[model samples]
Target: MTRCDVDSVVQLQISVSAKRLLRRADGPLRLKQIQEMVIAKLGRAVDHQQLLDVLQTSAKNGVPRFFVDGDMVGLTQRQRPGPRGCKAAGESCPLQPESFEAVATQAQMAQISKATKKLLCSLGGCMPLDDIQDALRVNGWDWKHEQVLHALQKSAKNGVPRYVLDGDMVRLAEGPSCCRRAQKHAATELAAFLQETEFSSCPWNSALSLSSFRGHGEFLQHVVQDERHSDGRPRFEVRKLHGADWIFATESAKLRQQVFEAIQALDAEVQGRPKKLLDESEDMAEISRLGKLMQDWVSGASWLTCLNHTTLVDEVPGIMTRVHLFDGDGIEVRLHMFMDPTETYIHNHRSNFFSYCLSGRYWHKIWGVPDGEAGLDGGHYFVVNRAKDPSFEHPVGKPGHLSVIAAHTHQERGSYYIKAVTPHTVQPQMDGNVATPVLTIYIKDKAPGPDTLVRVANKQELASLQQQQREQQTQDCRLEGRHRLERLRAMHDLTVLTSHSALRKKPRAGVPCKPSRSSPDIAG
Candidate 1:
């Protein structure tokens, strides 16, 4: 028996050479002739029947040959059957299409049915029942329309992957298999949309420590769960953005310009009033003004008014200008994506941290402890909830390096810190308290030419987007992030997540428990 490898594309029971063939004969021939011819030429005693079985099994048509007076055979595969017409490239191989049923079991079909309904509802409920069934039909699903309807009615309250709510109607959520880039943008847009549009007064809202940037899961979940007000205060469901998760109504691309304009309006009224003068009492009016302006934008009340187009002076200390790195054509490519994420970084003195990576490599870190592993031997990142955050500002103990006040045993309430440069080191610089090592990074700038540390950029536009989500949406995104964080834990490859079994009580440097990833979103 002959085996096929890269050396040749041969079949079993044959030892032939391409050069020996010379296209054998332009016309076709029989197997017996070639076998006999081989015997005659090589003086080898090759069995005719044995040769017939080999040819019949290996060649589709046995082989092609020149007839010697008509009663003969050939050694090529053409001996089996049809024409040797060449198929053009991309012509599908003759393999039959794999049956969908081969992959879809009864349970899978049920799941698809459920997922389909959820997707539809999330889309706005505008799609008729029949339309959904039709969608499945085109895709080769074997579920009945009733199956989909049942799933929708079942998960209407909590929302499944599909059938996300758009007001009263239901529509599809972005499917999981969508393109990665597009899906990410969609999630961001949707999260923003929900943030701008829906201000759910979730009882969880009180628990939500927004000032902390990242905090406990329960509080974050509270912020999301209250988006629609289960008590029936008019629902504002999240809309499907470009990706997997549904965004708040404010996230719509259609209203992006409007939202930015709204932020500008708020910015114009009173963006720069010195942080000192704007304390809670004296700045009460200003805070109200900014909030009101934001409300106007969310409400879509004003277009780009004279004030809307105007840029405000951002004297809100620490809310520095997010300057742009203009290219030759003066196109700004590198600018801070969001100022709010970094707000607590400036405010929290107790947060001992230092991290330095390129601008493209920042990531949000937050998660629970893993089982049976030692935590890192350094200052762990402490969660900061604006609601529960310390009221007074601490004096700068030292330029940027100090180790104190790491006393609180805050669990993994982390936020994203990306490397904006190379050889970055994110070490804690707080005084007192050594429960964990706060992972702060230092950057060495990867952008061209080296003008990185000046921090001269267009200040974060004091503008908010047109929020479209119902109040409940805000609750959804944060909670979802927490849930996703759990899955993300495995990705970090840190097995020493928790150490409950240890009897000797030692100071656990909590840094090891922080959520991280084996690979970052940006490619190396």
Candidate 2:
């Protein structure tokens, strides 16, 4: 078959597998589980990233009639997904004013006018033009830049309290005082300049001389280096440091894109090369190439995007990751973020992976089980039970001795190389009341493990493992719901604050400012 035909056949197989899996399950299946089933059906593994791409495409096209509920994928009861390109729901749907395409009709213009007023009012009268456009887009109106600016200009020409176009942003004429606007504009411009201008050297660079690092900040005031001799066991240490300028959210997003593209390109190139010709050292060189690409790409992005995408893993609480994977030979790359006050059960994977810390600190423990006895026993049994089956009363065996492969509290951008069979547990290193975010990138070799928790112990452990896992699933759902509500509440509060500010503004001349057409403000 041609490549396109092969892809079509694979797609068909995937669709069939998804249908079969959903039919057998009573509820939505975890994405990890679904991927496992699909892989088994295919008889050949597909990249995790490729699976996500398929799912994302399916979602966009409303194919196979599936819906994503957090990390789970399920067949929606609805015959079709919700209408796309539709504005936010409610009577105040910005689409009420005008259709996305044509010039705003009189009634439509009125609706747009009212919506804009409400938006500005909620924004305390004036906001960036880009922000205004974002609000419109969120409300489902896709107006072009020219269209928005034209409308703003028209409104100014009319006998109303017009919006002032100040550089890239627009502000309500009656909003913040001229002095306040000037101050804000200057600060905004300065911030933009700072963000855009590339620096010659980053303060966080690990290669800086010891004398240069002296008295840089209060945090480094008591800097003490460990003079202890190196042990043979894996000892994590800083491999690289991304300076503050390079660690923003927008910068992270750009880096992720670059890293993803680089991986995809590298995989394609490596696949065509003869396996016999490529030695271990050559493979390492290829990986180093990818790393260098990521470093080069990270120069201009913001750290805020990295934080924004920091998501809690569906199957594991206290563990968060921003993942990007590549096809061919199966490589999964992720930005793993750990939070404090975490209790994580020890588990092992069947892939050699590399981890590099981006920020914060974490307590790392690696355990090595004896060859004959490869599962949890003794005090460690509690950790296993807590992990696999918390409720079941299993006969606890005599405490087994586990060789500690490596254990340490790692801070800074430490690099850790973990073997496939080593079971480890990592938790946030606390500082007083808060647990700072521990950011790291994990590049796992080969396909991911089965959705079922791995245990080499006797069959007794398997008895209620699935049942226990099912019962534990609700926690993930609850967390997802709570996170969504929190974000919604924050947006609502911001809108309310802006609306009240608009209300308080004095009207131009003797005329009272027009009241917003939207419903009463949500309590801040």
Candidate 3:
């Protein structure tokens, strides 16, 4: 044979030997190890570079047989067959390996339970069972899918389960308390930090990394956990402003005002205006159209200019902050920041209005109650005469049991119209890291009369309402001119910061402007 023919025959022999060596080995081998093994199997004097060239060429060409990573070389996944029960070639078998017993030991079960709890806590207390099993396998546990499911089921039957299965979803039963504890712990740490420092509120990350805090992992868990009261109000004072987290003391009024102001400012700049009003007959369509327009509006002249005009900021502690954005010619615009859910009472507005959600989400329930049944059928009803007494000091009449006509989760950028006297209540959802804020535009279609007719499920709730009114009356005196203006100024700052951020994300088409200042300390 010619010299070229001999070279081809030797190359073929080397390729076969390399593949056989790799197939017998358990894992990747170094290039030198592979070369030594290949030469021994061939029982001939083979050039090292020649063997490498053949292997490298095989890996680089179509249908690569082996992969070369630096000096390490191993058979490509496609070249190897997967283990038993694996659906695809070279994929990790989801089923436990043959060496592992079909049933897990007591010690293995304990380990699984512990790992599952840790996973649940890290995953915000809820996840699919399949996902949990996959996570376990990835973490080196070889428990079968059936074994993991069995362990979870057994634990759930105990007096207090680490997790409960809902269909295919596994949820931590103590999720609320877990979050609450985290919140309390975080608040305590933050309060102590603030007391020692001159700052009122500290950036979330900086606080987490403090050497004094030490518990970095624990602090992160505490901060990120979603804390909410049984009533669905946010329990944590963690606020996200200008795209950064800020941990504020529960009583840090000045810092709270700054955060609120930042939100108002950003919202105003991003708020859109409708091109034309849809006839009142198509109220839903009209509201949606207006919402889209508002959401789509690009940053323009600062809405902060409008803040200078007549404005009223009102607050019902633990309930809502109502800011009168505009009021004229039988029309009113208001921005409402909700701190608590309003599901305790069902009521209707005096005027038909359009509401748009800027951030967070809420469940809006529409009720249908027959007339004159106002306080009958075991329901406590009251006439909220806002026109006669805007303070809501006294509820005049009693109303009756109501049925839910419709309900929907109102999400960000969503808008809806509520006709005058249409019974409804807005209950903010508890999925957010902070309280939700709602912006509403009220159009007075009719002259003011009885502002609202509120119905409660029981007398206990009616008593609660009376108690709330008394507390509100006491707090009303505190929301004075200075406080209102401070809120407005904060809102202005928020708008500027938000608008600047939006501009940074997507510069307004061709318009060019210098970047705005980095977010200022809200406490300042």
TM-score of each: 0.16, 0.35, 0.35
Candidate 2 per-residue lDDT, tens place, 1-524, comes to 01122376677677668767876884577878989988988888876555644553453244334544335566543222235233433212122112222334555555555567677654335556777778899999876654565466456434754665544556565533442343343323323433543321223332122232222221122111211112322111222344342211123344556667767765555446554122233455455555444433433323222323434333243355333334246456654545545735456766666665444567777655555564444333322433354443442443444555567665433455565656777788777888766655566665444222233233344445535555664243323456643432332232334334544775778884432211112222
lDDT of 3 at 195: 45
Q: Rank the candidates by lDDT, best first.
A: 3, 2, 1
Off by over 4 Å in 3: 1-279, 282-302, 316-318, 341-344, 370-400, 474-524
Tell me the deviation in Å of residue 462 in model 3: 1.3
In candidate 2 the C-alpha lDDT for residue 174 amounts to 51
Residue-wise C-alpha lDDT for candidate 1, range 268-308, written one tens digit per residue: 33234332111223323333332232223322311111122
The sequence of per-residue lDDT tens digits that candidate 3 reaches over residues 399-472 is 56656767777655456666776877777776456545444333333335445666555556657776776666
Count of residue pairs whose backbone atoms collide, per candidate: 108, 17, 13
RMSD to the true structure for each prediction, in A, is 27.2, 32.3, 25.1
Which lDDT value does model 3 have at 267? 34
Instruction: Give me the candidate number with maximum TM-score.
Output: 3
